[model samples]
Target: MKIAAEDVTPVAFTVILFLAWEGACRLFHIDAFILPAPSAVFAAAAHYWWPLLKNSFVTLWTTVVGFILAVVFGITLGLVVGWSRAIYRGLYPVMIGFNSIPKVAVVPILIMWFGIGEIPAILTAFLISFFPIVVNVATGLATTEPELEDVLRALGASKLDIMRKVGIPRTAPYLFGALKVAITLAFVGAVVSETIGANAGVGHLMVQAGSNFQMPLVFAGLLALAVEGILMYALFALLERRMAGWAFRASMSAAG
Candidate 1:
């Protein structure tokens, strides 16, 4: 099959970015400790491949597990909240207040409770990601047209039936959108907790590298996190296109 120009753009853009970065580092005679060139970063990644691989896996595992929990709980709670405007409004402030507390503060509490293991990282990821999913799903359902509901009601559809048949389906685009955002946040959450307390994970690796003055390795750890985040986001984006392609079609039709 032939490759699309669209598919090539991102790769080209990334290459250009890396080249610019490398050129700037050379032009400025930047110290590796201050900012490693992409070449040095790649060398570190290659040299510490095994450690990077193991730590990256640990981070991925915790992040994915926490993200899964967020998806299940968030979807259920979002559905319940969106079922009625009263509950949505009532719970909105509570959720906002909870989400407002920086995850960094909560990490220490989690470390105390979970004792510096993967559990804290997992929970931290869950806590960080949960709100966006809930808000987006709830918004998707709550924004359902009142006229549409009235017509369905007049046709003898029960509220539950209407929600099951229409509301949930319509919420797909929003849920998928939230999934993309939440997954990235979940990674950030995992890395943050790992940096604070965990024995394993890219965050911990970076911390070690920084203390040892291995700036290239530290940058390599960051590169690993960026790569993982991009992959997860792309997965959700693909799922969105596959599952909610109709939403796009509808929007385009309206626009035209």
Candidate 2:
């Protein structure tokens, strides 16, 4: 099969943007300490490949663990709240309040409670990423059409049956959308935890580099993070397409 124009357009644009960035830095003779060229960043990554990749794995593991916890708790609570007006009325406000809390502000407290270790890091990631999943999942469940509910009811379907067959299937796309956002937040939480108190991981490396003014290494760490985020976003996007193919197809048709 041949690549479509639509696909090639984005790849071309990305290449152009990268070239522009590389060219601008070189043309301006920017200081390495201030803004190193992309080439330098790539060199740095190659130089410290083993250590950087190890740190990346540590961060990746923490992010994945936190994401799993967030999805489990968020989906369970979301389903309960969505299915019951009484539960929603009583708990929505509290959930909203918790989400409104600045995640950064809670880092110190998290450290104190969970210790300056991976637990705090994972908990921080979970907390930061959970709200979106909860809200999106609940919204997906609660927003089912009245006509659809009526049709199911007329078919003698029980509440549990409706939920399992209709609600969850419909809600999956939104759940995956929430997952895309959650992945980035999880990474941020892990990095923040490592930067503040932990000994290993990319965030710790970044902090150490910054203190010593090792600009190239700092840029290298940042590049690693950016690549990780892109990979995660791509992974979620692919999964969404696969698991929610009907929803994706409908969306595409609508857009077209």
Candidate 3:
């Protein structure tokens, strides 16, 4: 079963809000320039469909790249730290300090280093979004049952064999949990970075729309971004359901 509330909730809420918004705009005789009705926003989006999709793809690509990097680096570093006491002790403090710093504050430096393009946006997304994944994965890997470890060792399993047979498999759920969080942060980070210094993306389009007082266009851009985020989230949820079927079933059975 889907972990999410049924899609009907958001769909119904959106339909009702749009109807209310349009009615309010008509009743108040609001000018389209101020707060355009949902209809007007849809019309604008329909008219600009191609450019909107193009810009969306640009942002989507950056987000995807950043997310992949975060997962790879986060999982790698997490495994290294979790499996080695020395590295864990040595790097834990530095990781905490770096994570404490506001990632957005480093955007200027990122741009200075990588220039105002996809690279900077992607790097910013990776930098800000990777810490949680790493921390959670490390914790999960390290906190496995000590009794299990002892049993596996008595059975003559080597360190590598134990890690392969037990550690990573057990940590999959935690890694995916972090993926859920990382995906959203990755989206936000990419869009925010693009907004700060991008010439071509949905964020850039929204900035342009705001500058020209196109509130409907701004709303439309935001709506598109929201849709993209929802789609990404749903994709992850679907993958999780499929990949964790046994675990999810076990969870459900236990809960019941």
lDDT of each: 0.96, 0.88, 0.86
TM-score to native of every candidate shown: 0.98, 0.92, 0.89
Model 3 lDDT tens row, 106-135: 878888888898987888789888998888
Tell me how many clashing residue pairs each candidate has: 0, 0, 0
Residue pairs in clash, model 3: none
Position 95, candidate 3: lDDT: 98
- Residue-level error in angstroms, candidate 3, position 226: 0.9
Q: Which of candidates 1 and 2 is the stronger one according to lDDT?
A: 1
Superposition-based RMSD of candidate 3 using all C-alpha atoms, in angstroms: 3.0
Candidate whose TM-score is highest? 1
- lDDT comparison, 1 vs 3, better candidate: 1
Query: Candidate 1's error at 223, in angstroms?
Result: 0.4
Worst 10 residues of 1 by lDDT: 247-256
Residue-level error in angstroms, candidate 1, position 1 = 1.6
Candidate 1 residue lDDT tens string, 1-256: 9999999999999999999999999999999989999999999999999999999999999999999999999999999999998998899999999999999999999988879889999999999999999999999998999899999999999999999988999999999999999999999999999999989999999999999999999999999999999999999999999999998889879653
The digit string of per-residue lDDT tens for model 2 on 1-256 reads: 9989998997898779768878988999888889877788888889989879989888888888988999899999889888977997899999989989887788889888877878877888899999889889889999999899999999999999999989989999999999999999999988888888787889988898889988888989988888898899899999998999898778668652
